[model samples]
Target: MLLELFTGKCPIDECFSGDVNLPKWVQSAFPENFMQVIDSKLLVGDVCNEDHDDGDGDDDDNLYVSPEIQVEYCLATVIEIGLSCTRDSPDGRITIRHALQKLKNAKHNFLKNRNGEKM
Candidate 1:
């Protein structure tokens, strides 16, 4: 729940719904402007509402992304996220830190569970 409220990644249904264990200082690192490109509507304005049967099939050209080109998209997004959050605003910095700590806690819990270690 906290992660969803903070990360703003994925759909609301896909968001993590659990209490975040990040400290106040760490939670303050992530920026409040965090955004995720879930739908292409933001990229191509009103494109979804356009007529597709106009025979241009060139509408396919507007849809540049191919499911088969997964590797390129995967790496690009990974790099993009890694380099994102420049902390241009104070909220940005806090959001980054909070999201980072939240992710760290999730990783820690996963490792402990896998190793049968107590946390």
Candidate 2:
């Protein structure tokens, strides 16, 4: 569920034929090409809503961490939880309660990071 939520891919996605399911597909892109595997929408950060530029076409010298990066960190944490839940052995997998707590932490951290950056 976490993998599907973050990566925007399903186990039965058409691209996942043969033995390649959502978890494997995401794993292949892990640790390096993760940005490619995740939902591109998450990175846009309001490119469609309005122009947030300060006319420099660059960083604009803002001190806050961009929302895009925060989402990426949150996504990475969620994906890790998904992978942990899908481990080959039941012993290796995290319990549902544990996963829930970790997810809550990830969300808390994401919100905290965003709030901290703004202040």
Candidate 3:
């Protein structure tokens, strides 16, 4: 479910017709580098542009919340949660409560880095 949500690819997607299902595909896509697997539509443009004036009307190049970095961090965390949920063995998988807490933490951290940027 989480894989489908973030990847925009259904569990029964044509790519998952063989031994590689959605979970496996997603797992292989991430772990090392998840950028290749993330749906482009989910991440586009900057969270907030640097066009705003800070009293002096000069360009403020100090904003550290880069769109790429912010989105990358959030997506990585999300994919990690999804991968944990999709573990082969239920005993090794994360609990629903644990997953939810991790998700909340991811969101909190993601937002905190956004610097009040709108989605």
**Top lDDT model:** 3
In order, what lDDT does every prediction score? Answer: 0.36, 0.78, 0.79
| Residue-level lDDT for 29 in candidate 2 | 87
Each candidate structure's TM-score, on Cα atoms with residue i matched to residue i, is: 0.23, 0.75, 0.79
| Cα misplacement distance, residue 75 of candidate 1 (Å) | 22
Ranking by TM-score: 3, 2, 1
RMSD of 3: 4.0
Clashing pairs in 3: none
lDDT of 1 by residue, 14-99 (tens): 33245422222223443331233222232333213322232555544443333222222332332234334333465544466655
Error of 1 at 99 (Å): 0.5
TM-score of 2: 0.75
Candidates sorted by lDDT, descending order?
3, 2, 1
As for TM-score, the candidate ahead, 2 or 3, is 3
Worst 10 residues of 1 by lDDT: 33-42
User: Which ranges of candidate 1 are over 4 A from the true structure?
Assistant: 1-94
On residues 1-119, what C-alpha lDDT tens digit does candidate 3 reach at each position? 78888898988887777689888888887877677777878777656545443365555545545656677788899999999999999998999999999999988888776664433
